[model samples]
Target: MKRILLVVLLGLISHFNFAQNPTGDWYGNLEVQPGVILPLVFHISEAEGIYSGTLDSPDQKAFDIPITNVTYTDTNLSIAITDMRLTYEGVVRSNALIEGTFKQSGLTIPLQLTREAVAIEAPNRPQEPQAPFPYTVQEITFDNKEANATFSGTITLPKVVFKGKKKLPAVILISGSGPQDRNEELLGHKPFLVIADYLTRNGIAVLRYDDRGTAASTGEFTGATSADFATDAQAAFDFLKTHPDIDASKIGFAGHSEGGLIAPMVAATNKEVAFIALLAGVGQPGDELLMDQGYLIGKAQGFDDEMLRKNRIAQEMMFTTVKEHYGDTEKIKEKLTIYLENALEQNPEMIPEGSSKEAMIKREINTLTSDWFQYLIITDPRPTLEKVTCPVLAINGSLDLQVPSQKNLTNIEESVKKGGNTDVTTVEFPNLNHLFQTTTTGSPSEYAILEETFSPDALKVLSEWIIEKTK
Candidate 1:
């Protein structure tokens, strides 16, 4: 399981006065956890009077995020990011160094920045939509009474001239885990945005939204689990069902990763969900998925078998601890801590720097006890897939390491077909990563550097399958 790390605004020094104009790529590393270094890049540029720049976390695959309010007076430098409620303050040590602290979500970490390069080239995403899009785009809002929250999203309809008010088939796009914007923006690539554009251009109506408590949506993001997010998707379905231009019988759901799991959860319970398209969705229980993820990713990263075995054992024990302490949140944390500490004592190298066994155990405890992880560990999509009688399409990238393509696709298809759902289709595209982007190595780190967002072939398959089902 990955430790939860917050992304803070990367700062750059622009010489407005005595300070040497450090207008270039400044690089730093944050110890997100023991031995794990997250690379952060800040590109500073000076035009006239405006200090405009962008931030990129190469490790996270997030790039060109706008950093605002850049003001630096000599050694005293302060950068503020209003969107994330974060600020970075530090001192410029010389012509080449800046030492500072990154503050976000009430957590602070020391960061030392050095001039990495003169300039860094941004990733090329030519698939991103330009002006004069061929789809009719409209911003819309819908309310989910169960969570007492309102969601904001965009609906894209094919631009073809219809004979009167045609009832077009529609699909609601659900993003993977984490708080995502309407486009499911990640690493410099907006996969959902590309997919929505592709589907809408192909004459399929599409709805994609910001997660509750993310972007323009309201409610708490930290405490809500995947099931809670499913309700929001259901609400989107309800809204689409009543749209004046949408066909009630052709409305469907297209979910990615965790969103794929949620698609079945909603589809199984709500008969109105006509179909579902799962993209890199998991078919096993949440806890098992985590353990598998750790093993595979560790293997790819060149971790020894012994190290991976220890990881798996710790994961299994953690799951057991949580299961045993189910509803007792406080006690669960305590039990999980003891469990992990014991595991770490047995394996010393597993402990990260700047973090003792106790600290590592505490971090794991916090994550395992959260509403999301707690719910995720126990939630199984197999039963829900079995109950989903609607036409289903499950696709995974051959290079997808997070959700192994062969295992998950086979299991998901089997589960659906076992339920007597004969219309299920599963496909795995070669050389594509979790985001369906063509890559050399399907590593998560490769996600941002790759210029291609969503694979054209994947988009074609998804849009065609969705269109065929809606028909």
Candidate 2:
């Protein structure tokens, strides 16, 4: 939900001759918070100081990044990289320990650095056999002039057989809200991969890829909006339509979460799209969804009914005011700050009894409070949906908190009907979370611990709907 840069400061002083090379491998650990430590590795040389590094995150693929601006004096050294907006300020102790704080994105997080005395090996995890689907995965890049960016991603295809006797039906997998990889599924479970395998085995081909700025893709992921992401999906659709093995007439799209919003947009312009699947997509404006999300999260965290009501009222008011003054950054910030201050004073116990007003202000301001959230609050998905003429299948999880099932499903159905399309089908899965995993108590915290893949029932519903419609 928030974008943060990781910075590590290594203070190492070298008294060696200038002619001596300053190239070697360095190791360090970054402390984003009291208990959150991220391990990192960087290599420095005299010509470029620190130029390349990798971040150690179990959930993220290892990335290659550049470091710049290295300075050393006596036992103190300072290094900074403007490109990453991070700086490492530290001292080299007599014991050869490099310690400092990594500063970036208007906050200074702590970090410690050390020389790698021996080679450090990456952890070994059991690798599953190649996906059962007869598909080939390859990286591809495309340009998006609307967003002023170029992005890269992987395309998974069913291996050609029988000398391409017939073009295969294809679908593009769109991810939900987050920095998702090409698979769009993780944590020991791959929903897209499962769908791809099932569809491929059934004689349908699939294409899945990383979002514009995630994983191997190139571009800034943080500054993007749902509309921007839609362009990325459109690019992928264009790629598939041109593939030699793909049936241009049978191309379609399937989206999850925010991806659902993108499906209609892509289908609207390309009449050739055979169909669309909206899995837990949003029907109302983003602002309404945010307030609902906040209320749900607050309630699940044990906030009383009165407290929830007050919080929702304040959030709605703030969002409404923001919508009224979209492009005026100064007025928006001033009004938001005043409203947040008043809201805190009204219910001092709303957030913790002893929390300071200043602390609360800082926390609220740090969130998505600017034009992005304002624009999102007023933008509705119905306009795009009405333009879509293809057969539509919209699904929701009854236990979803982010986008309440009843409200979202109602919106989709109403929009489709208004568009003169009576063939829309809606499904609400009981006890299922946003990710379509069946769970009694659904919460974001539960996501990191749950290992179940996308529900088989949900997949069956989708596959059946697509096959039936296309037939």
Candidate 3:
């Protein structure tokens, strides 16, 4: 998210005798992207003349994260969250103002802290179901014995019972890559919750749960990869099959983004899956897909052709190094360091101001060689999609930049068809973004600003297809 720092026009300077101490709530907005804004607040308290505090990322749902170290002397204020690898350095420009730079990983963005609490209005989501919903919503828990993970989530069933007649068809919702909650909440929009409500209203049962180590789920998420998450989805499917009201033969999955990649992963090996709906799923190899993503997003952000080319080259170097040295982390790190060093030598600007070359290389190595990235870059989705014989509905928006609709959707359809399974449908909706929200440009900058969580047309397509498939 991109945020602009609000300038405090009050030109009042405080006397040295009555300086404003770095104590109390200091609020600021971080423009993470070109147009996206993430608001952060630091609550500093002084005890025995020593500084300590907590941090809040309001939009990201991370609250009260302890600030490991706080150093304030004269007009300088520095805060560090060692666990999160975040740091902030600021100058107390005025009694009520602190001009600072928020640094995390390797990215740095300007932040203007103010004494007054800034009000951030939540995006209006008319589609978010109000209470008195038309279905039965139950807070539930299921266990993944393989991961030794216990997941907490919600299951919404239609009000009508089908005891002795036909059992209700159900779908398990799988979220994209991240620490997603049951609702797969992002940018104030809960697409899974909205989808669950809609499907349940139309007589299909829906189960959605938090990811491992997120919300109520118990497991270590940091080191887990997509292969590990598939077990969790399998657990949800197994749990639903055991439910008296759910049709064991009709259970399926609806996954978005990375979740889209995961749906096929489970279905490919599990014949019990009746069908799967891939929401902007990954069909190409992870490296190629990510390269395309970077190019498209860069173009949307108005990056020059030269810059885009340079970025793509850098990405290729990183991806190739990782793919070539998939299992050997040490080799991967060594090669990545060399590549980064060479790139930095060619362009000193590669290293951000105030950050050392060593620090930049380390951050790059850690991120590029992560368990998830390593698996993703080297792993191909075509083989997985080809193995999925179950009925499939792969859909994406024409304007989706993250996963370019044409290339991915085409690859998905072709791969599935090559497996000699004709029971597949793929649709590319116009004017919709990766989240399927109708937008002028598919840039992520528009996700928070757009009111529509999931398009009515898209929702209807998903619900109707699942109903028809179950019947």
TM-score of each: 0.79, 0.72, 0.87
lDDT of 2 by residue, 283-317 (tens): 98888889899889778867789988998898888
Give the per-residue lDDT of model 1 (tens digit) for 1-471. 133222221123333236566577788876544434567887877777566678887644467887866776666667765554456787878768888998764458898889873233455789998869987899999999999999999999887733554689899999999888998988667888899888888889999999998889998888898989999999999998888878898898999999999999999999888899999988988888888888888887778999898889888988978877777899897787766767778787886533456656756777789888888888878888999989999999998889989989999999999999989999999999889989877888666667799999999999888877766
lDDT score for residue 252 of model 1: 89
Tens-place lDDT per residue, model 3, 337-407, is 88898898887765655456676787778888889889889878999999999999999999999999999
Candidates 1 and 2 compared by lDDT, better number: 1
Candidate 1 at 326: error in angstroms? 1.8
Most accurate candidate by TM-score:
3
Candidate 3 residue-wise lDDT at 81: 68
User: Once model 1 is optimally superposed onto the true structure by TM-score, how far is the C-alpha of residue 336 displaced, in angstroms?
Assistant: 1.5
lDDT of each: 0.83, 0.71, 0.88
Largest lDDT belongs to which candidate?
Answer: 3
Off by over 4 Å in 2: 1-133, 159-165, 185-189, 351-356
